[model samples]
Every structure is written in structure tokens, then in C-alpha cells.
Target: MTKITIPLDNPTLDDVARHADVSPATVSRFMNNPSIVSERSKRKIEESIRELSYVPHAAARTLASKKSRMIGVVVPSLDDALFGHFLELFHSHISTEGYTTVVASSGYSSDEEHIQITQMVSHGVDALLLVGLARDESVYSLLNKKKIPYAITWATDDLGEHSCVGFSNHDAAVKITEYLMDLGHRQFAMISGTLKGNDRASNRLQGVRDALARRELSLPDELVIEGPIGIEHGQKAFKLLMSRSPRPTVIVCGADPLAYGAIFESKVLGVEVPQDVSITGFDDTWLAAHLTPSLTTLRTPQQQMSLLSAEYLIAKLKGEDVDVPPTLGVDLVVRESCSSPA
Candidate 1:
């Protein structure tokens, strides 16, 4: 194949059209309304642009279309695999639709989230994706005042006015707790993520409590360990739980990372999983199935939720009618890590 390189200094739409064997008007249509462009033409235009290394002028595109073609996303943190996987899928889906994504981490702080939202708005993002609905009311008001379309992920509330695409954390947790109860495991200890300003974490903890209450059982204050989400925290929390006079038969972790840490610590302490004490975790991450005992976890529909959230935001930006976002479901993945009380 002959190498073709267009001048980087001044590559124009006409040049792109000539290289792609299409008219200038066709090139403009492909740039602005890619949805209407045929697959053949789309491929040609894309290949030509890549070959020539053509860069579109953002200001010109914005002026012509009256859109920034950018989406802002704010999450608790990107340190964990769960959030990282969701972001990867979400970004991939939106990029195909010609929209760019900008992400910010709140470090699990609502105040920091407010600041990030303000910065994204100042940068002129056309839409936004918030991880959860636990943000302050002022954050919503800010988006409303700016007329920016947005959606919430990680948890769902149909009764709420805001658009959200996620499953019920409370219900999922309840299901897992009931599963443990069915296995004849009575004593329960929970290693939970910090619940402050995090509806997902709080709801999960509540679900466990509700399930335990129905069984005439309660998670004693001494058995509940709430801390930052990390492997080190999980290890320390597991050690504390095991040190109790009457240790729990099974431990439920709020997230997979914590569960992984607990499992590792159990081995380090010469305690066998499911033989010594069973364990469960939420959000079945990639490593969940590969662990020594294979973690029992709830598989949250992160990929589907993220894809739907991106689609909702894009539709709203394009002035299309969008129905109420659907509430996704979670699946209980029974693995080797969980079993009847030893």
C-alpha cells in the first residue's frame, strides 16, 4: 500500500473528501451526522482521516452543531476494578457515537464531587454521568440551571425524578444474606464500605440488616466493620472479626476487593475458606472466579447499565424522546468461597 500523508499544518475538509473519493458535502455530513452515513462511506471517511492524521477544529464543529460533543462522568474513585471496567465500557460505547468523555473522581466525597461537577460544567460538557444519586441537591440544581442532561449509575430509584440506570443494592444484598441463611449459617459478620454519602453502600448494609432482622438475628455492633475500600482494610477487618470471642461462621464484604483481602488473610492465618469460615462479596469482578476458593458474589450488570446510561445521555442530547430508564437486576454467583457453617 502506498503511504499517503497530508500536511498537518492545513488539512481541510476538501482534502479529506478528495482522499476518501467523496464530495465535500458528504464529508461534512459524515462529520456532523454520522448516524445517517452508510457503512461503506463511514469506513472510507474514517480510514482517510486516520491516514492523513486529520484533526477537526473543535470550535468550528461546536459553532456549526451547537453542541460540545463532550460528556462528563463523576465517580467515587477509579482505583477499584469495578469502576475501572464500567468506565472502559462506557467510554467505548460513547466514542462510537462521536462523543468524547471526561471523567473525574470524587474520592468518595460529596463535596469533592460538587467541585468536579462545577469544573466539568465550566468546561462546557453537553451531558454528565454521576455514579450514584447521593449527591447534594445543589448539584442537581447546578445541572438544571445549565440545562445539561445527566444520568446516575450504580443504584436505581424509579420513584425519583432523576434518570438512573442500575439495580437495587438493597434487594441484591438481601438476596445474598438470605442465601447465607439458607446454607444454615447463623452467625454473620459484615465488612462494609463506608456508608456516609454513599447510597449504594448504605442500602447494601440496610438490606443485610433487614434480612437478619426477619430471621430474629442482628449484626452486633462489634461484628460490623466499616472502613475505606481497600485490600489492607479488608485484611485488618477480617483479623478483627476472627479475634471476636464468638467469631462469625460467614463474612459478607460490601465489595469484591474487601472479600479478596479477607480470603487472603484467612489463608495467611491458616484458616480454610468455607471449611473454617465462608465468605461472600458484591460486584463479581474479573478476579472473583480465579481466586483460590473462587469468591461467591453478586454479579451487578455494570456493562449493561453503563451502555444504557451512555445511550440515555446521548438521546437526551439529540432531543429524542427517552422513556424512564429501566432498573437492572443482579445475579447470585455461588462459588467455592461460601458454604454451610463449619
Candidate 2:
């Protein structure tokens, strides 16, 4: 038996040039300005590079360009589908432009976010992706001092001084609330994730109130329940809501997970959804559409915003002057979970 040894040096431009019978400069031109290379020569170089399993040295490229090909992303948790989807979309777009993402979870703590940002800055991430504009002053100070490019995501504000790539949380929530109100849901109860540290949650609650205020309806102190972001939190909130003498005809959840919990709890309590009480949620995750009775939710363009955020940050890091910062729209998805007052 004859054993053959395979070389592991991997292919480089010189190797590609040798395989294609061209100079190294031709291969470089093919990579940088393909338009200048002859079509036949371009095909030969690409084919050779592929056949040789050639991977360009990223460190060499970074050394030549003085750019760290990493984007830092900070989020509260990886458990949430919205954030998970955002991570997937964000990384996919950035990777196409020769950048990688470094993600850190802040554990729903503002202080933790500050620490994460500081660490990411120390690691020299080219840009940062933050969920909302609710970080501590130190985080902003660090970014400004380092001149690190960043874009606030998920929640949009009209008065955002920094570049943002998201839809208006307040507006989206208000639109959803108005749709429910139009269904004649007057006695309202809310199952909201804790709003102490999340601007997105706070803005959503405010949007609900803003719409309710239009009809002189508001979330009563007893009717409003706050808990951590989860279905169990929604279950607890639902239990609380049901304890009222004249229970609310509708329940508004800050997120789809919480809404699912509320719906699940309602089922356990033998309460019929939308027949006895209508429920609505924000951030239409994939499961929202597949639930027993499809959830009426706010169709937030989370993936679009995440992709655009990565694109804009990568562009800024590459010194490209973008004429417009990316911003996506959110729409209210009316479904079976919500209906006219029972």
C-alpha cells in the first residue's frame, strides 16, 4: 500500500498564480478589481483557489488595512427568539462584508451592559450593536472617547442623537393598542416584562397608555402586572388579572413569550381565549403564527433591522459615508387571539 502525504500550508496568491500561469499581481487585481482582469484569467484564478482550498490570511489583511474585522453585539439574553433571530440576521449580513461578530449577554442588567461594552472596547471591536438607548452614561462615554462606531437597535426614538436602525417602538405599540381599542376592549389589563431597565418595554407600555388615554382608558394600578420576560411571568400576570372582581376583557403583553404564557394560563384556568378575553402581544415571533389560535401581534421587522444595523456599522467602519441610516417599519398583525369584547 502506498501512503500519500497532503501538504497543509494552504494556498496563497502565489500558489494561485502558479496554478493559473499568471503573476501574483494579476491574482491581486482579480481580488481587488475583478473588472480589470480578463474573464478567462479571472475564471482560472478562482478555480485554482477553490481547488487548492485557499483561505486568505485575515491577520495579514487586517495588518495591511488597520481594521479589526469584528462587530460587538450586546443583548440581554439569548433565550428570547427575537434577539436570537436578530443575532442570526446581524451576523449573516456582517459576515458577507468580511466581518465577524462578538456577542455578549448583559443578563438584563444595565451595569452588566456597561461592563460588557467596556470589555468589547478593550478587545477593539470595530463597531458595537446595542439593543436600545437605555445604557448607562459610562457606556456612551466609552464609545465617544474611543470613537467606536455603534448603532442603537430594536427600539427607535424620534430624538435619537446617535444613528439608529429600528422602528419606532412607541408608534408600533400605539398602533396595536388602537387596534384592540377599536375592537371595543375597554377594561384593559397588561402583562408586561419589567420595564425598569428596558427602554423598549417602557416605550411599549407608554404606547399602550397613549392609545388608552385617547379613549379615557388607562391601565389601572391593580390591573397592571410586571414580571421578568417569560411565559411564566405572563401566567402569573394572568392569574393576577383574573383575580379582579370585574376582570379585564383584554390583556396586553409586552412580548410574544409573555402573551403565550398568558394564553397558556388562560387555558389551564379553563378560560376561553378571545371568547371570554382577548389577548395581544408585541414582536411577532415565528411561533406567534403557529399557536393554537394565531396571536395578534406587532410584526416588528426585527431581522430587517438587525441586518441593516450590521450593514450600516460595517459601512461606517470601512469609512463609507452612508447617505441614510437604515430604519425599518413595524406593523400590527391582526389575528385570532384578539377580537371584539365578549
Best by lDDT: 1
Superposed Cα deviation of residue 145, candidate 1 (Å): 1.4
Report the C-alpha lDDT of model 2 over 1-342, residue by residue, as the tens digit: 121124337667687787778888898766644557888998888787777777877667557655667889999998887888889888988775657889999878898888898999887788999988887777778898998998888866576577888878888888988888888889988888788888888888888899999889888777879878998999988988898989899998989999999999998999889999999988888889988778999998877787778778877876889743546788888899988986
RMSD of each: 2.3, 4.1
Worst ten-residue run, lDDT, model 2? 1-10
What tens-digit string does per-residue lDDT give for candidate 1 at 118-222?
A: 999988899999988888899899899989999988988757788888899999999999999999988999999998998999999999999999999998878
**In candidate 2, residue 342 scores what lDDT?**
69
Residue ranges of candidate 2 with Cα displaced over 4 Å: 1-6, 9-61, 323-327
Q: Model 1 — which ten-residue stretch has the worst lDDT?
A: 1-10
TM-score: model 2 vs. ground truth: 0.87
Instruction: Indicate the residue-level lDDT of 96 in model 1.
Output: 76
